[model samples]
Target: MARNILPLHKRDKTDTPSTRNASTIVPSEQAPSPSHEPKHHHQPHRPRHENALHSYVNNFWRNEIVAAAAEFAGTFMFLFFAFGGTQVANTAALFSDRATAGQENSGLTQAPNTSVLLYISLIFGFSLMVNVWVFFRVSGGLFNPAVTLGLLLIGAIKPIRACFCFFSQMFAGMAAAGIVSAILPGPLNVSTNLGTGVTPTMGVFLEMFLTSLLVFTIFMLAAEKHKATFLAPIGIGLALFVAEMVGVFFTGGSLNPARSFGPCVVTRNFPGYHYVYWFGPLMGTLLAFGMYRIVKIVEYQTVNPGQDFDDHEAAAFKPPKDAETAEQVGRPNVAALAVEEAVEEAVRIVSRGSREERDEEERIDGRLERGEQPRYVSERELLGRTGHGRV
Candidate 1:
């Protein structure tokens, strides 16, 4: 295959669309030699309706199902750990009271102590970090309904899908919290009984401000692919930790409305906290979206022009130029290649390895039979296989 390389020039910050387009492509026509014929690349064509349907199905899974699942799982895990930690905090305090009474009067705060605050904060932080890590590849770690709504406002997510994801996160959070509450040994009174954290209106506004700051931090960290990628969760977690420290005494620092509303619904304690839960987080999210737009403008000017937007948009908007050529192309199909590689691996294992290896191979094959893709190994492992070694 003959490759055509296009050299890209940096456009001025103030360049108009036409001026940018002028600098974008510099076409050069090369005369063909007697030995080398000019190769014309014809775009692949298909029936418009068939093509549209194929494209829609492919994109539906990529943009909807995969995206929604990531949001759902992230939200579920976050609520599970957060509310679970809250319950644990309450239970531990109950036990601590009994222990401290037996001994001489030691000056410790009563049930729902400082330790509870720290533990709950840590759980919320850790769960968020894990969810971000898991879903960053898919939905960009948008675990919050408010954040999703903000993205919709900025044209990041489609309006219809945004509504679906927001509701999904809320429902998932509530269900997960309810399940956690049920499994734990306690008075199963579903009427303002359990620890459903709520606070005053002032506290709600404060939480909105703090959550806005936190969401802004997430936008900034995710916008760039630097050390901030790894630090995003830490930054978010620490922000939550600090917020909790300041606001736990007032309203449990429920920066996440789903986190607050979930427990409240499960425990059946509608202490008018729902108003703040909806309005505060949504307000903060919108504020954060504004901050991101400003920051993006500055960042865009500073960063060198690259393939990020161009490549992404091309994949989304354009069809392959040659359908027949694409089908005939012999390059490895990543999905198919993975399955073949896994099968070969299993054969090698069963042929020469231990019982454990055979059992593992069977398990892997079962997953494959059940339509699961091969497990994605780390970049280091991939590099090693390619003989380029690690970074």
Candidate 2:
């Protein structure tokens, strides 16, 4: 479906530098209240454009910290579920075989091959869903470095903040995987084999392709802002599941480099698969960015649909001269105007009310007092009684 992209509006145009820079600050003007006027002020302060920019950049960094922390927590949780599931699956397979041998006379065997695949995929999928649910509202639910990098490429994220998110995700992934390894039972055969999910060279390429596809899906879903944001994570998880099912035989489906690196580091079995872990996922991230750019050009005519670069730049500068003086502004105070009109109308209505109207009001009041259903009042009458004019 074609998506609606919200246009970016600038709050201040003065602070923005002619040359675009990542660190530039943008300041927003506070609208003067109805009770205050520019002429009533004793003195007007000159705009401190540089100071405003400094504050803006500082606030941006503060928000970046919060975003990076969320990314860390989400990535950690994802890796914990993923690696923990792998451990449990491997152990189950081993015990299942042992049980089959014990019941040899029964001539029945439960291979657990399908079960393992299903469980692993589900673990990854569920992790993604939960993390995204928890963090989407806060940090856009970017739990992977590749996803963050793709956002940067499309200018959805500032370069500095994007770098922080990427590193945070990588470290968090590594830490979570290491922790899972420490708590699990000694090396299963899978762990001994470096826990590499697929064959080497082919696995790398597959990881690149699958990761790119996953990221591309995220961009498409995210562009549709009217839809629930939670769908991005669900879509991403399902994409991962499908890829796992198709690629598990060939490459173990390590679409995320950090996911691969974490287990390998803790197991102390890098085994030259490091090339795939890093290069493969990096290639995938770049490919995803490129694919998203192509799709964006074809679908939306812009690289990113919901971003507010113009607003960000405006926030860093001073207001323009043609802007109305704070005193001469004629915008009505909605709340105050509504209240005043309501009061005036209500007084007038009460002064003109008949005995019948009074009795009806009393009856309604009685019904409310007795917890019975009250008679519905007409909109005109209700508005008049509430001190608002006719609807």
Candidate 3:
């Protein structure tokens, strides 16, 4: 080792970039001190492509265009399944050999017509359930324009976004109807007024009443936070199923305007009062709004009995058990408790003083009635006369 040692001046410099640059650098007139050396900030290890992709994704998702596109896609998927089911049922019934009408067979009148209704109901309900489950997080599962309107009226969705949702739903309905019409036979493509038999006026009322109940159910079970929120889709589907069962004959149970709109447009057969579908659902939304308000009021009263009835404050009320547990875990509302304590103390002080004054006045009145001289003495005088203030 001693034989191999070399002087620092004769040693070869490393060929690294920094060493080469240092060697080639022209010496400055004045060299900066070590303290003045530039501190290099090292960025954390990250792929450039990853950062680019992340920014693109973040901006894309937040864009309104993407939201509207999502709405369109969800609505299209929903209507495709809903109307496709309808056409399938209708086609099957048309080709069936069994007597759809109530006819006397085997010495008994056998009506297979009810089977069609049942089939349609189940299909529609299933379609709704699946679509809602699939698209709930992205588009709020609003496959119906009326539902979008309801959300708008309830302040759940903004007006512009609601408009986009409405347009998407209607367009999807129309597209689904057209596709169904094209795929099925000519005779099968013809719409059946959604199977409604009632007059226009009766149909409007039926739709309004039924849709009101449906929207009411949605508001109560799905929109509000509760145990049933997880089962909202099922509850909504059942509500529609029940409404269909009740109003299927009277108004075709077309609670959704989009459901009716598609068939009407494809067939070009506007049942005399085409506006009924729109008017009915919108009116039903208003009724639902009223019902939701009443429900919120009742819920508020039930949850917070002693609190003021304020709509904005209703949401803050928790379940009984949760509230009690929260009260135990956290400090109570100190300001309100302090105010109550002050009020109670004031009342107690005033009452005690008033009672003592009444007793002294009563004693004086009794003495006067007995023909004895009554005296109203100051505290200092009484203390001096009694020698001790206790008496």
Candidate 4:
């Protein structure tokens, strides 16, 4: 320190020229460059390329969530017309009621109007058809929980997505019923009930058969994924139409638990046999799935496939293209994929092999390279015994 402050002439003997060299900074001890200095500017809390909020939203609204939203909206619209028409049917039935004037002016009961029942059938069928046609591309227009389960069983939809759709359908069913009750003026009769003389046992089996018919149509039309897939809604709607026509009279024709659930929620009524709606539909889903599998095993399309229009992949009745890869258009073959991978691995192995391996690849003329020769050329030798004059 004294050497730095002192005049050269006044410096101590220890601070001489050679010793003073130690007082100055060496290159190794120099201060850090400007870049190495601590930065004072604030850095971003999130990455620049991806926004945290956007990533969160994308994950929150995944495919399952989007499908669930579509299910909720579609189911709501489906049941809105359904419940509204049911109320109208009940009201219309009142006008259709005919009372016979008894001799002593006695109170009389009237049977339900058959015409009103048909009207209910049309309302449910047309509502399903229109909404399914509108929303099938988005979320499969599966307003019914049983249909969703059918798709899940057949491997058309994932488990998470099925769960999301189930909850969405249930909530939408209740909402539709609530709205109908609030606006319409009539006691709700949409809830399922066993008809007069109809036992609980009969109701369950009947409900199962009706629901099975609906699910079977869905599997063959939609899940099978054929040229007629676009027209699946028509068949599905009609299946519900007939099922409802029959079951509506006996079991309220509740082919769907959601259909049964909504009215119960609105009217605040649960029949002691409410279990029929859920259990019957579930059993029906299983039955339809089993039948579809049986047909699949037997290759029914090959046996009695009706018209062999052999339609094109997209449009029903359109002829298929004359291409070898036509059959593989939508179907993924694992064996084909394995062969592709095997070819790639062979190419990679050859690419890294010795020069000899490269020459061994398939050739057009079936000829060896110029300088290469067969390890043993028997015929070309001409039995040298004769050539040596030993014959």
Candidate 5:
């Protein structure tokens, strides 16, 4: 089946980014209430050029441009802090020791001091948390390609939008790296590679495991519709923090492929196994989806014992009565209910017909083509059986 690729304003069904303001700001004639009627209904029609310009601006703002711009801005902000924090920490450590020189002089020195580790971990983690909150309403706040990949695979985001997000994140990373490189001294080392003595195999495994944790955490918190959204960023941040604490020494704890790719793009420092950054996190995201499916299976069995999973029934979800009313009143762009209802009606009409039934339908169509009024055939007439009243 072709996936529906509706605009963000049209597709989102969640409570976040309430379209209430947009709707209320520009009340339409379709609004049922008299109080919502426009004050200038008698005004003359707009000029063709003005109408076209208005439509262009409205469509651009609500559909394509706004969300992509938000992603770009969010990704840029995230990478700025990420790269800047690493550089600042390294520079601080370098100056901390006068006798030390070269790579050992930086905060990224092999010793793995508690203070430096905590500082960098917290900085990256909290920076991600802040950006997620900032862009949550605008772009779903997915600053990582791994997260975007997971969402794409799970059918959460459209493939086209996911591609845009991936490009935005990578571009932001490159830009941030370039800026950091320009700001910091030439000799300072701020690459995202694994620490000294860490083998490529070990680094890959570490990245895989950490990214799995991060992606899985996002699935459990941010992606699930029933879960509270306000704390989703916090949960994601904490997951990153945990991953960094353990995986930092092994692979620089870079769960994000873009984060790893950025520094490499700037420094031209590609290891023989630099491909691990792409492979490991992507593989981890795939695994996270499998894990999420298992959880869903377990939950389904617990809630509906002895019943086989019905994909169609699950997909045809009806919101609660209050939710339906809330959506009608608050979200004007929500056309999912109408779309689903139309689809359901089409399916019902189609399912009631078989190959033999199609022949009957052709006869009815032929009669209609002849301009004769089509007669309704009751089930009893078709089955040659009497109705309950007649029998």
Candidate 6:
């Protein structure tokens, strides 16, 4: 048992990074340290590649799936209520007992009743607003394929994400249509069809123009990311509402291919002008894309004229293409300009004070010259009451 014990050199506990660099841990179960600094814990450091992989998986794969699922559910919700309301609107008119043999088929074709048209328009608009408000945080509540395409073109979302969302919305549309068809006793009259006196050419153009308005609004309001972005659902819903009001009598206002495709599939009756919906939205997407790109390249905010922009207000906007806008905007010497303004204001105040002082002096001199009692000062030879070398 004659083992020699080596001297134990105690290590210094102070050999560690400062609290600024060290990790802070506060456990609720344990009492805090008396020293007003955070207690450090021994935790393993993760590799950069692991962090990179985690980010990629979460953002690229996991988020894409979650977004797609959200889009599916959101689309189903939007189209379900929309299709159900249409069914009600279309089916309710059929109960009219005043119909004769000479009268038109209201079920197969939308009736020209002003009340019904307004009802359908409001139903679609309000449904969109409500559902978008619900799912916007999840998948942006993009219930339309045209919206996904527009976002893709504007680089708001990746192409892969757009594809997933597009497919999800399409299938969801079909599901909504199929469910509505099953639950409702009447025909699935929600299909997009040309109205009276509407030609194929006219229908295509109508859809194109209508969809353009919608995509443009989304680009400006939602995708652009401004102080008013939270109000995007309202604006977007109203855009659809107005478009429906205007075009409901023309081409059934099929601004979305999913909306068109689902009804066609459920009824197994595709109109010859069915291509109109697809082509029109695609063309409109291109239009919105072109406008968005042009505005971005030209620095659209450059046209802001006579605006007294504050910190909370948006003084400028950038296109997704020019997101990294290297071009400097406004005066770079902001502090200097502020200082100059303050100096000018101070000068004005000083000048005003001097002018008032001069005027008071003039008034005092006038009273002195008049040799009046000058009631406010001593009445007996009151030259000393003034500052003009009075004695």
Best by lDDT: 6
- Compared with the true structure, all predictions reach lDDT values of 0.62, 0.64, 0.65, 0.74, 0.71, 0.77
Q: Which candidate has the top score in TM-score?
A: 6
Q: What ranges in model 1 sit over 4 Å off?
A: 1-58, 98-112, 187-199, 224-227, 296-391
Candidate 3: where is the Cα deviation over 4 Å? 1-63, 97-112, 186-197, 300-391
Q: Between which residue pairs do clashes occur in model 1?
A: 43-321, 44-321, 44-322, 44-323
Per-residue C-alpha lDDT of model 5 across residues 1-391, encoded as one tens digit per residue: 2434664433233444565565666657655564654544354478655544465587644544566778878988887887788677666766786344225422243345666667778878988999998898888999899999998877888887888888988888888778878877754355556676888888777788899999988887888753266789998888888888887666677788888787777777676777878888988898899998888665532333313224543444443443323232232223576688789999887787666575665565566568665355553354233222132
* Per-residue error (Å), model 6, residue 99: 4.8
Model 4 alpha-carbon miss at residue 37, Å: 46
lDDT of 5: 0.71
Residue-wise lDDT of candidate 2 within 1-391, one digit each (tens)? Answer: 2323443322222334552352334332444453554333233468755644465568777788888988898889887877777667756665767642211211111233676667767777777877787788888888877778787777778888888888888899779877876677756222212122346666678778978887787777774443355467777788878866655444556677667666666656665556775676688888988877766456542323323224433333243344334222222345675689799999888777866576666666666568665345573465367553321
lDDT of 3 at 388: 34
TM-scores for the candidates: 0.55, 0.56, 0.61, 0.63, 0.61, 0.65
lDDT of 3: 0.65
**lDDT (Cα, tens digit) per residue for candidate 3, span 1-391:** 1332553322323459996577567476454555765466444588555544465567544544555667677767766776666556655655573355321111111223677667667767777777787777776788887788888778888888888888877887788778766776543232334232457777677788888888887787777755357788888888877776666545556788887777777766676677777788888888889888876655443444424324533443333653433233232344676689799999999999989866765675566568666354663354455353333
CA lDDT, candidate 4, residue 324: 28
Predictions: Cα RMSD each: 27.2, 21.6, 16.4, 16.0, 18.8, 13.8
Q: Which of 2 and 6 is ahead in TM-score?
A: 6
Candidate 4 lDDT by residue in tens digits, 1-391: 3345554332233546765575455564574565765555444498468545565567645667789999999999999998788767766665455342111111111135567678888889989999999999999999999999999998998898899999999999999988887887755556677766778888888989999999999898888777589999999899989988887777778889998888787777777888998999998998999999888776665433324234332232222343223332343444666789799999987777844433333231133334334333442242242241122
By the TM-score metric, which is better: model 1 or model 4? Answer: 4
Instruction: Answer with 4 or 6, whichever has the higher TM-score.
Output: 6
List ranges where model 2 is wrong by over 4 Å.
1-57, 98-112, 188-199, 300-391
